[model samples]
Target: MDQFLHDHPITPRTDAEKQGVVNRLKRIEGQVRGIQKMVEEDRYCVDILVQISAINAALKKVGFQVAERHVKHCVSHAVKSGEGEASIDELMEVLKRLSK
Candidate 1:
């Protein structure tokens, strides 16, 4: 077992990538606030549901982007270093949660 495998690993991301994720999350935050306002204003139920759906989809997209990065960097590194099983297991666990 690699010593690094048991320890937490840090994945370095570029400033652009960080900013992109931040931008996406900010938009989602705004969407959520809009939904709250819609509720306060007594907007149509179906319209509010539609906006909620959009926010859910947006959040899933952001999650997938992060997962892709995790697989490319963390999983690949673990595999190359002969510590793939644990990393893959961790990834699969999170994937299961994401699917739900």
Candidate 2:
């Protein structure tokens, strides 16, 4: 909840794409708020942990989506502009980390 938006604008997304991201974020926000309530109610440790796992999975799903867009757009643009090798290498490195 303490997140600060950067002055730089996000690359403008399509209505559908933006909505998709927004929906995912909203769901994540609700999950976080639910976790807060769980803590307040002193929920069982395993129950909290299950929620934590679900949140983590949701976050990673979002990460994969963003990563897919980066590869399809940003990296493709770079490759088309003749920076292909560097971009591909960079992308591979990122994919390796993400897959871990």
Candidate 3:
């Protein structure tokens, strides 16, 4: 896992791919700010909880997109290079945490 941290993606994301993720992240950031404002305004608890849930779902969606790309590119490259086991194990460990 430590080694994986130092490694770069075998196939780097294209500008479009990066922009898409960045766009989604920016939206999520806005949503977070909105939540902060809601708190300041003393919004209803249920309303705040709903927004929090939406944010969680949005984050999970982004996470899955990233994981899918990682598996398709990085894991595939590692398998071809005879480093599949370690790469897979590392991915699985993180995935387990993600699910939790």
Shift in Å, residue 66, candidate 1: 0.1
RMSD from true fold, candidate 1: 2.2
lDDT of 3 by residue, 1-100 (tens): 3365347777888999999999999999999999999999999999999999999999999999999999999888888888889989989999999999
Error of 1 at 35 (Å): 0.3
Report how far off residue 59 is in candidate 3 (Å). 0.3
| Inter-residue clash pairs, candidate 2 | none
lDDT of 1 by residue, 21-95 (tens): 999999999999999999999999999999999999999999999999989988999898788898899999999
Residue 2 in candidate 3, Cα distance off native in Å: 11
Better of 2 and 3 by TM-score: 3
Clash count, one per candidate: 0, 0, 0
Query: What stretches of model 1 exceed 4 Å from their correct place?
Result: 1-10
What would you estimate as the lDDT of candidate 1? 0.90
TM-score of candidate 3 against the unseen true structure: 0.93
Order the candidates by TM-score, highest first: 3, 1, 2
Model 3: CA > 4 A from native:
1-5
Worst 10 residues of 1 by lDDT: 1-10
